[model samples]
Target chain A: MRLPRARGPLTERLVACLQRPPRSHVALARTDGRDAADDALALWILHELHYRGFEDVDDAWEWAPSLMSMRHHLERELEERLRAEYSRSEGSRSGQAGGDEDVVAVLHQLIEADDGPSLADHLLRDGTTEQACQLLRQRSVYHLKEADPTAWVVPRVVGRAKAALMEIQYDEYGAGHHDRVHQDLFAHGLAAAGLSADYGHYVDEARLPILEQNNALSLFGLQRRLRGAALGHFAAFEATSSLPSRTLARALRRLGLPDEMAAYYDEHVEADAAHEQVALRDVCAVLVADEPHLREDVLFGAWACLELEARTARDLLDHWAAA
Target chain B: MAVEEPDVRPAGDGPLRCRPCPGGPLLVRGAAQVQGDDGTWHDTTRPVTAVCRCGASALRPWCDGTHKVLSQRGVNPIE
Candidate 1:
């Protein structure tokens, strides 16, 4: 995909540097820019280097120390903010388990306690066709490349956890059927709905919350120290996907969207049912059983996943309402 | 038109176990084809497939996570 339009000064400068030949020290203007949409955009662009470098940009820039430092600066802020929010919500270490409780049980408790707004419910009930399409565009940023971030963690673990993580990922990658790859399925859904199926087509249109959601996943997956959080996020993500997918399917049909689009959600209804179990029991539980020390990090990641998703949902819903 | 069955191989030429997940569906592993309630053969496409134990599932023979919804209303299909 071509480079997206720069959102602000940070992305503007970063994009300019990326267009040039790979250099050791392309100085970037310093800014805290915490919670700024531009900050998220710059970080997303930096993370994109590790995934798929832009066509116009030199691939060698992916490892440039100058860009890496900017990425570190932004990630530090995002991680601190996420941890602070997690701590505030947790309020007194009473909710923190000391690796004694079953990790799956703890994950379930967190899932059950999540009283976040449901975007699927809104769409199924009363959301407009325009709103539905808008949400799909925002979601395409990640759905177009689903299950990839977590795949990064596979090499970082061993034993049953390694085997189990692969099992879940195999299904996500379409269980040996290229036609059934989840990302392609989503791309088909987007095309059938008259939206752009090209990867990163919607990044320029995606809101800050959407960008943050994507950034957090990449952060957890890239850091070996955050592998526990990666698996935690994976388990939480799967556990919550199935039923919402059902509602989403119904809403897509209700709004007279294409069957291929609805079918994507339909596929998730069955796939995630199986995935949730393996992710929770086989992957997260087995990993915790082996490491034990990563349990808290697991919980932290799970909470981050749920909280960011909730924020995304609320932001979109509120935007639609006010519009 | 001729139709051929999907190429699938079980881990071994031995019996495979259907491991039940507490509060969820039965997980069958090591390769097999499941016969749906409608008597159609469905190949095990993934490393593990969660066969629906809860009759409320929208997808027969495959769990659609309806069990979690059931559990909310005091139904434990896993039991």
Candidate 2:
């Protein structure tokens, strides 16, 4: 988690500023159309401070006003890009779909309509060991702390939604068993695959799309206004996870890896299948049914999850193909 | 019981020869073993196989791409 190697000017300056005490007026401007690797990783590092600060960077930088302001600017740019990419629908769904009927039906429609290519299939069928390793590295950003993002919504939601979310998160946390927790399982997977299990070990090597995917969850989870979206995001994730996890497990085994090496994916193959029903039914459906207004935001959250995942999949597949 | 070493032979030409599951109608090509319902097992050397990840595949322990459709719809089977 030490400060990653700088990608370009933005990261270089940002990393330098982080090394010292936060400055009040550090220039935060960036030119347009710069290599995404440069900008996105830099932004990711700033965001990472909020999660697990780099090994070399001082912990004080997490709340430093200057660092926060710099991160704010980058986030604004990222948000603008996201807005341009994702158009809000003019449907009757409420901004806060707090009702049951609206949440389940809308979430179902959203899940049904997702037609993206299967990253799991590609991994199961043709993934090389190197590619799988890279995939784990990119995913380490979020998988290392799997359920924390949605946990942000626990207090923001009420009644059934809150209860349902807690129920799902309880399983995500291994129901009080530390070894069974998703994050720990992922770390174990990393170690079994001969990669670093220490958190944030792969920050410097990860691409922009990967960072953006994790950032979306963090963004929605931290903002109270986006609570419905956060629910939608989690719902979409659980719904789509089971088969992919199974495929990934097969892929790992194909590479002569042991069951422990495939433990993370194997665990998800079962866990997410049940989670899908709970998310769509108890969590989303109940929330929307009660609120009745946040349907579109719910769909928006689901779509954003799909869109980001699609981008990540395309990027990883393309990189592997090129290599 | 002690583990026995798998029989290895020189490659012959015929679709890169794979080991068929002894307990079911499944083919696997990799360095792994699949145990069947009758307590029999087969070792495979093929580089790839469609093992069933979902317990419900009509073709038990062999992938028939059923997971593809299920995943696209975001249906969690564990539930």
lDDT tens per residue, model 1, A190-231: 999999999999998999899999999999998899999899
Q: What is model 1's native contact fraction?
A: 0.91
Per-residue accuracy of model 2 over A183-295 as CA lDDT, tens digit each: 99889878877889888888777788888888888877877878877888899998778777778888888877657768888777656655665677668777777766666
Task: Give chain B TM-scores in order.
Answer: 0.73, 0.42
> Residue-wise lDDT of candidate 1 within B23-59, one digit each (tens)?
6787888767766766677777677888877767788
lDDT of 1 at A172: 87
Docking class of 1: medium
Best by lDDT: 1
Name the lDDT value of residue A11 in candidate 1: 82
- Span of 10 residues, lowest total lDDT, candidate 1 chain B: B1-10
For all candidates in order, the CA lDDT equals 0.86, 0.70
Candidate 1 local Cα displacement, residue B76, angstroms = 2.5
- Angstrom error of the Cα, residue A121, model 1: value is 0.7
Q: Count the backbone clashes (under 3 Å) in each candidate.
A: 0, 26
Interface RMSD of each: 0.9, 12.0
